[model samples]
Target chain A: MSDSPSARASRTTGTVRIVGAGLLGASIGHALRRQDVDVVLADVSPSQLRLAIDYGAGRDARDDDRPGLVVVAVPPDVTADVVQAELEAHPEAVVTDVASVKLEPFTELRRRGVDLTRYIGSHPLAGRERGGAISARADLFIGRPWVVCRDEETRAADLAVVEALALDLGAMPLEMTPQEHDRSVALTSHVPQVVASLLAARLASAEPGSLSLAGQGVRDTTRIAASAPELWVQILSANAGPVVEVLDALASDLREVSDALREPDAPGARRTIADAIRQGNEGVSLLPGKHGQNRRFEQLIVMVDDTPGQLGRLFGELGELGVNVEDLRLEHSPGAQFGLADISVAPDALRGAVEGLEARGWRIAGNTND
Target chain B: MSDSPSARASRTTGTVRIVGAGLLGASIGHALRRQDVDVVLADVSPSQLRLAIDYGAGRDARDDDRPGLVVVAVPPDVTADVVQAELEAHPEAVVTDVASVKLEPFTELRRRGVDLTRYIGSHPLAGRERGGAISARADLFIGRPWVVCRDEETRAADLAVVEALALDLGAMPLEMTPQEHDRSVALTSHVPQVVASLLAARLASAEPGSLSLAGQGVRDTTRIAASAPELWVQILSANAGPVVEVLDALASDLREVSDALREPDAPGARRTIADAIRQGNEGVSLLPGKHGQNRRFEQLIVMVDDTPGQLGRLFGELGELGVNVEDLRLEHSPGAQFGLADISVAPDALRGAVEGLEARGWRIAGNTND
Candidate 1:
């Protein structure tokens, strides 16, 4: 989980004026500061602004310099106006806004006759459900993906500056068109949050005392529901249309599943259930792989008893084997036997992990290739 | 995480017949075997039958001894047929099941005119996604929930016996009607799996290059998608209507969110998105506080830098505080500064945990009681 600091600083051709002293703003400032680049941090709330300053994200605006770059990190609704205002105050600063959805802000800026040659859009894929400058950290962007979007009019130099900033913050630059970014996130991120919340919402209406028995599956699936409301609104509103498309497809699948269950004994009923499962299977396969597919991990399924010390011993064995576990997932179906732990190890090391477990007389299911 | 075992052996009224020597069957046999109670294990697969014996879930069929209890732990599609056979073969034995969905098996047995006095629909809220006797665990149900549905024909003594069995297995007994159990699980369990898989399937089609940047959120959200397909089909089919209903509602919310994003400035769009987040917040509240609503400890949300060694120090301070953590959930969100950690402690020890963090100048959020 540790990412080394960026040893070589890319000399910035422009200074980025980061307005908004919240998590994103502070992080941007922190990243720039670490690279020893000049940055001016501004915020409406004096307390928040002071916090950013105290945290060393940036110094005061009167730092004897005009910013060549401006990154606006604020709420979704206020983002565009902030960008234009920053642009109006400094006509030369190549400006970009860090917001979840791009199309709306891009249109708003274009409508106001902003300098398209200097402007671009970006959103760094690094955050917690928690918010505020209080939650800001310097390495927030380390090894994270920061998405950058540019249209035809944008200057190549401006794009490079943004890319440099992303790299300076320890984030990998991901290039995509505005529409592509919005749609992909709609399927990948936005829709999933809504689904998680809706699913968790049902627990409130569950018959009395039913939830007390809830296990890890419900806990994991509903984890995102605890996310802050204002933040989600910013995300859901920005990518609403694309998200709706995915939901509509899911609705169609659900309807068919419903009809199929009503008459399970009817002709083709078995196929109906099977089809729903297959559709779900197909749908889940579209997600990005681990570290955006840079790491290929094999799923090692080990059947573990419900006894104490079993998991510890199994993990100890793996540790002894020196199997570098990339990830671990536990499945607790509703009333079966031992839990199956699907561990992700380096693709090449999986055979060893499995062989080690097998030699220790552990019953393994499925090959690592699975 | 440890619970004391039952100090005294449970006095069994008679032998228990467990049909289907797969994971669940073998588990129940192991649990009861530890209690020194008689159990008979049966299954369609001779290999599975042998594994159950090898695992010591039960003795051979000749030891059936006219069981006083019969448990069905097979496929959902065949539950009713097998339960009917068990009922016909041993009319004196009380019947129960450890299947995912209850209504189907209950109705199936009733439709076949099986005796109701000895029949009580029960579902143990413990499991692994894996199947087969090789995966069986004796204490699978320990400290979990065991839901039992009782009818007028269900003998009070038999219900008590089942409850006693649940307690002996270290599970808390919960009461539910057949319909409620089916509907609740359909929403909370089966639908989430489908939804998670549906989400994961989308990742499979992701540009291999783009997929590399995938992070923990995507991985956690899509975790359940890796579950076995056939088992889920049986579960979804058995509780189709309610599962479909939940999915339908989710789809509606998804459509609304999507439409809002397409034209975010449109009337009522922002409120719609906000409502979805608020609904999710409320849903999160309904989940059992730490430890299935039995908060054995207090919760402390610590705000830490995104830098390395920060978290290790935070945990080290907790260890120095002389308080052990029960569980932890970490996230790397998209577009945020710092990660907020919610750590739980006993109610009385809450202040100490807070003091320990604050003494070290860690900004902590949220109170256990509040």
Candidate 2:
């Protein structure tokens, strides 16, 4: 439960007060309570405050001892306002935020001349389709990555405390600049949602019969389209520059492919198609590979049954054979005999996993190694 | 078990004899058997045949009357030879091949002057990650769609038989010209796969530590990357023209996006970014909407608890309110007070679902019809 690098080496009696009592704040409180850490949840919205308390986010806020830390969980637009308020109330407490974008808040904090030593910026890459305090869960951060953005001016003690917070919440702590974090998220999350939403909106106007022919492929591409426009509008506007930049790059690649298709008979079509595919391959590497770590990876294929027990049996076998199951994908092929299971593992495990499956009475065919 | 539109109309028992006891063939057998229709499963590989039989795909080849429908479900390259073999042995049978792509076989069958009245082209929109008879299930085709393609010269009875076959399997039957079917699929499924694969392949080579920050968005985009390249190569090569066209269009869009990003402050940058998102929306609409139907939707926010019976309670409220939920998204904000639930229902039912929740001691917020 403690992957965060900043967690204290020794146990102690101290409170980590989470200000805002929203999604991130409440979820952190929930996770902390599970760890037996003293926590207090504060929110200006009386309704929101009551919800947090009733939902067991934390006990009511108290003004006694200076807190070990104060985590500001709020929207990017109002984050600095809440953070400044928290600082005024608890100056000795270290602070951090779990906002989607960070650059603006950092600047706003600096302008206020608040001691910057005790605060860091954290964005845990764990969330669902919903938002707000009611959506908070103690286990939401488990086994997920948490990025900590630190500047040269960030105090080491505060940074360590923030890392400890992430660890206590059961998230892996990662270090990056605010810019890098924003750009990566734009490429991976924000942009995709925008794309999905736009697509979904279009379908709402499409002819019913035409869309009736839709299958799983379309479903996959549009899964995130159901996101809230209000939330996305805030997110996109906050990270507009980087997010727009990534989309521009993607658009250019799309244009080149379009041109290549226009001249199908030209000898260049193959190269263009090949290049497009290759480009996608390259871009995808920036994502966390199958290990849920952002490692660059080649794909490996394994066939698995669609039945409930089959997945369990397959996972159990891979474990027994010492074949690291880095990541697995199940294609939603409609009415075929068996579901094609593609597993992405280290290059080293490819051969063994394939051979192991074959020996275990599984039909292992095609190139098992990428 | 009683969905055959033509079963009572025609007393003929044997139809669609599937050759090759593999995944595709087994699924075909399963779908056909559900209609109380007998499908003979055959394979040159005796062991494979036994496996298919074990999975209840068919009876021993020694049994039954001459089949009216003959299907070749072997690997793509062998599809032609097997189709020709079945046609030769069962001259009275209407024949088809369930290959991923059909241009080659369609031409081959034409050259052979096989009974035009007894042959057509069909592809079912379904399959799993795994393969072979052991993984077969009777309900594989339920509610999925099957595409049956025909040309001007196609026999009337052949089209009817295949359409009936689809109905018998409880699948929606869609009619298309062979060329149209190929191009549509190229846009919807094949190209998407190549793109996903390309991206996933790229992720394979990314920096190890950075990949840890990869999240669900990347996973969703690259899910199809784990496909078997050999199988994919065959599919792409067969539909190169249409696939190249779509990929090129995508590439064109990508190019525009990249060019805009190069000059971030340019007016063109904003326009390009918006266009890319808009196009994505347009493309997404080409997909089926929620619940396998296209319906205009708005979301209703509900505060749901994380307790054991809480989800049930929320669902029960929705059910009691008589709201047919169109879609639902769940999120757990880390530090927030409560989990957020976004339920998509028809515009008319937004008030009802919300009212139902509120009446059950649940709190509702945000925009709802009520």
Off by over 4 Å in 1: A6-15, A294-323, A328-370, B1-8, B11-13, B202-214, B252-267, B294-321, B330-370
Mark the 10 consecutive residues where model 2 chain A has the least summed lDDT: A1-10
lDDT of 2 by residue, B244-345 (tens): 766665555555554554564576565655655555555565565533544578677665543323444565556656665444444433323234456666
What value of lDDT does candidate 1 attain over all alpha carbons? 0.72
Q: Rate residue A2 of model 1 by lDDT.
A: 30
Residue B355 CA displacement from its true place in model 1, Å: 10
Can you list each candidate's DockQ? 0.30, 0.15
DockQ-based class of model 1: acceptable
The residue-by-residue lDDT of candidate 1 on B64-123, one tens digit each, is: 378877888888888888777777788777777777888878887778776767778789
